[model samples]
Target: MAVAPIIVHPPLGTGGRRVTAHGRILGLAYSDGDVIEFLRRAGLPDAEELLDDPSWVTWRGGRAHHYEAA
Candidate 1:
């Protein structure tokens, strides 16, 4: 298995804080590593692939969102 390249996106909010797909606040965004860790904690398979692909992630109301890719 290979590690997918990280795709950096702007933080969900003005303060650059981290939040969940549902808009639940997590904390300040630090690095891609933190996102990966969050995904891992959420038990999402192919977390790296999902994070690397912009199509896999979305944003609404300035909140980061994610869903299963078709």
Candidate 2:
């Protein structure tokens, strides 16, 4: 597979971070749990643990799993 196929985009001005897979939008994540849920729905049952795995997820505009502005 490709590195960071899943991307958690920067947080929006209001709230939430956009989550995408292969450039396809999956949903917005307001929390780490929300991110995990999105990944779970995308077929990654171990998303919670994979949150810090750069090989699977790429965090942009902020720290990994962080949905708040930096």
Candidate 3:
């Protein structure tokens, strides 16, 4: 049996929560430096602007694994 990976949207603000398939809520960090560090490792340049705000949070819902900006 394979455990599905939890889907995470990019951090929108200082903090957020992501619900996993197993129903666990993981805290999403959004400190400017922290977000920058994560974005640096994430390798997505398109999201640079989104990481600047300190009060934005993202999330995805439904049975499907598609994540959209929130």
Clashes of each: 0, 0, 3
| lDDT of candidate 3 over 1-70, digit per residue (tens) | 4433333444344334243323444435333344334544555354446533323323344222232334
Following a full C-alpha superposition, what root-mean-square deviation does model 1 have from the true structure? Answer: 10.1
Which residue pairs does candidate 3 place in steric collision?
12-56, 12-57, 13-56
Candidate 2 lDDT tens digits, 1-70 = 5668988998898888999999889998899888888889989898898888888888889666667755
Q: State the weakest 10-residue window (summed lDDT) of model 2.
A: 61-70
Full candidate order by TM-score, most accurate first: 2, 1, 3
Which has the better lDDT: candidate 1, or candidate 3?
1
Error of 2 at 63 (Å): 2.0
Arranged by lDDT with the best first, the candidates are 2, 1, 3
TM-scores, all candidates, are 0.47, 0.87, 0.28
Candidate 3 local distance difference test against the native: 0.39
Candidate 2 residue runs with Cα over 4 Å from true position: none
Q: Once model 1 is optimally superposed onto the true structure by TM-score, how far is the C-alpha of residue 40 displaced, in angstroms? A: 0.8
Q: What is the C-alpha RMSD of each candidate to the true structure, in Å?
A: 10.1, 1.8, 10.4
User: In candidate 2, residue 62 scores what lDDT?
Assistant: 69
Predicted candidate 1 versus true structure: per-residue lDDT over 1-70, tens digit per residue: 4323333335443444343644444434455556666766766666666753655443333334332221
